[model samples]
Target: MNRIINPVIPGMAPDPSIIRVDEMYYIATSTFHWNPGIQLFQSRDLANWEQIGSALNKGEINLRGTNTPAGIWAPHLSYDAASQKYWLTFSHMVNMAGREFNADSYIMWAEDIRGPWSEPVYLTSIGFDPALYHDDDGKHYVAILEWETRTGYQAPGHIVIAELDMDTGKIIGAWHRVTKGFTTRGCAEAPQLYKRNGYYYLLLAAGGTGYAHGVEIGRSKHVFGPYEPHPSGEPIITSSPQHLFSLGDPDAGHFEMYNPNSIMQKAGHGSLVETHTGEWYIAHLMSRPLGDKLLNPLGRETSIQKMQWTEDGWLQMKDGSNVAKMETEGMAGLLGAGSVSHDVFDDFDQQKPRLHFMTPYREQQEEWVNTTERPGYLRIHGQNSLFSQVNPSIMATRATSFKYELKTHVQFHADHYSETAGMGLYYDSNNWLYVHLTYSERAERMILTVLQAKLGERMEYVHHQVPVPEQQADLKLVYNEGFADISYRFEEQMEWQVLLKAIDVSYLSDEGVNGEPGEIGGFTGLFNFIGSVDAHQHDSFADFKYYCVKNE
Candidate 1:
């Protein structure tokens, strides 16, 4: 048994879907507005996982301008035994205005793991968090959270199961609503199907995707049923379990519920898988609060808990507690897989850019991204400011730290007017900080500047213009545990002068960062963005020499 030493997939990698094919395990997470969407990970043992590539690279689905936390939702991965094809179903959440919660679901199929996947088939007009089950009768059924908006019906409605003809894109069966009572947690989503012994066990994610989130289990004697709740009378694993019938308890199933002793917080929404050796594991999305009550600074990440079957057939945590973090030793040998890998530190030595490059919005404009732009550098053109939610042409990776340094070098041959372009930190359309170089119109001197904006707020702060006698410079940002200090220097400067404004980086935390009221949460960490913004479009391009991040 191994407890997680470090959470591998951090930041906005929520609603995780995991499946083990043969000897290896693969996981896919929701990629909101980021292009080259659908992050895929591969691991040998359950403890470590590394990002491999995007499953939606073909520009398969459409997201007109869906920004953060809006593009791709919870993806359910499953393998069809009869067709021998791996299937992925997810919600392309298109709009969230007035909280109308507009979304359409689609399914993609692939035979090989590194897929030249099939075109996305428009599967349902239903709702998000869609899961697929290939029943023993060779029928394909889709389960989803039909998002509800009525005054009486609980939000996200109920978990509905229907037969979907993948070939014809139509529903064959009536929508069977499984759990409707408020205590099942009005938002029962992520319905998962498992066939064991003589029953169809459905594991569902209930409660809003918030502090109250947990996994619920119901079983039917048949594929479709008036399913009954598990016997223990509570969720199997959750942070807060129900003793009273209030909405505040963390959701869980009953058998061996709370460990009374574990350190992890609020764990639930688990997807289960059995290894080649017949032992079981649950790959679920859970979060770690930074201090106390801090929205996950890194957002919802994936964690695995070892599980085993009880004498009565209900799955129990290996330690026999409803808690989800206990380690189950010696399971790697059962899966015949190795261990998870390390973080990728790539500098693009190959012909094409490394797979980690992500453009916001669709991969539409080829002119914006090119690995061949330079020998060692990946070039992503900047079209607009940190202001526009659409077409930012920004490429970023997970911040992964409370204290870290990001630095980059750039050369700008701008027109007399197309003032600036350089590097910065990006958190969605609203928050950003860029260290750039621009020409001083009054002084006739080439100057360095820092332009930062708090939210999508229109007012920007341009730090005092300083002299940069040379053409190129290195811009650096030291994000200490809770504050950000930016500095820049010319070709051979010895000392770096800090800018006047030192932003309190803690404001970027889960609860502090500003977003739409109840609309966007701040667990998603910031990204280093090398940008080119020409408010006075006089230049053809701004060239970035290289971008690097490392600790002293």
Candidate 2:
């Protein structure tokens, strides 16, 4: 299945929440900054998932102030059979600023998938990854991993289940703390609750969300119970078929760290979905190491594998395999087609923005982004700088390829101030490189300048100017690996002149960028954007004639 089944959704699409409603399978993945947050993808055939929309597009939840590796966490998508409503539960990680671990869980229900969703109903305040359990008892329950803090003597955290009041959106009982130190890895999260035959099973992703991550299982006679970990004491599903670290970071799990003789690594934190075809598959997160050195700048993405519950009530992959590298026989031909999209191209005639987009603190306003400015072009108004968490005048799509070229044709008038708007690859506002068009003070014409920002340093990387005699110019960038060659031409120039040539872009990687300790930033891949800054009045409106990438 490894050869035929690759990650359908790539690039930081971790902590997948999947559910099958009728003939359709709807999936929601965690979005840190990418807006239209909680990207909703639907597929008739599991293999061909198309982004229907986002679960949280109303901007009811704000993630701008939410810190890196924080923001919107795991979102579980489910449908209530009794109520006939679609429900989604997710953590609004509000307080990463102090590492205070103050996050709030919210539940929203709608009659339709594309919905006028009900206002957020508060659920739990103690945990981050929250999943719902609906049993035959007609009772609703919520299971979560309550976080561990210094104030508590609980070591770190334990699994907690409580009677959930869906009507009032409250937990009716004390959080039942069960299954401690059960996972060989100290961290057990993304609990998936279910009941089969006579046992109530709780499957969890164990270890950290890293290389040694695995899937562990425990069950009880009751929802909250005297649960027992699997007797094997190792994850049922893991890439490295060894006693790897189930605890902290790789160094912490450092004891079990070794190069696995396989193509997939960091295969953990999965969600299970039972298909209408009566087959079971795991839509778990996995990473492909660029060089196997353990630095994953691309972040965890979703991969699928087939599994079955044993007679002992434990779910296992076919042939009792050690994370099968070959195709497993399960949902054969039950999948769908691969949606062929070029990594570089923005046709103004898309249903919504494609799967790769996000607004920082808020959702992109239709008022701000309108194609009505022109028939074949996109027009985005200028707002604040990209650095500010407030609404930035920017709309971007992800950089999906290892080797690709992104080009955009944007027309913007720069006024008295150094109002510049152009296109280039962006990670975060703190650290990014751009080739923007600005009005040169010395020269009367608008000139293209290389604005390379290195976070809060206030010093630009390569800020030389170029004269673009025309208002409209084509800005193109060729990112040969990390290093980039950015240039611009006004149809008058025969050749694409080199603007900022041969810049070592490895620093843009997670390990290279400037971030504090314990925080590896920007799991999301590179993105292309056209932005505007008017420190003065309203001086700029970026008219994007077209945005294309050399995805081939």
Best by lDDT: 2
Clashes of each: 14, 8
CA error at residue 446 for candidate 1, angstroms:
3.5
lDDT digits (tens) for residues 367-479 of candidate 1: 86566776676555556655666556566666655567777777775544345767766766766676777777776866777666664554445447777766677788887
Give model 1's TM-score versus the native structure: 0.89
Q: Looking at model 2, which ten-residue stretch has the lowest summed lDDT?
A: 249-258
In model 1, the runs with Cα more than 4 Å from the true position are 1-3, 181-184, 242-266, 326-344, 416-419, 492-497, 500-502, 513-525
lDDT (10s digit) by residue, model 2, range 1-552: 312355666556777888888778888888876677787888776665676677778778776655455678889888889988998888887775444567899898889887877887888789788988777778888888787766534434778889888989888968988765455666777787878788888888776655566777888898888887877878777777677543433212331443467667767777778888788877777665555455554566777777887887787776677473423454655543435463646677663444455666557877777677566667777777766666677777655555677787778888754577887666666667777877777787787777666644444543477777777788888876567888777884567777777876545554445555544444554566776666567546778877777754
For model 2, the superposed segments whose C-alpha errors exceed 4 Å read: 1-4, 151-155, 245-260, 324-330, 333-344, 349-356, 458-464, 510-519
Would you give me the overall lDDT of model 2?
0.70
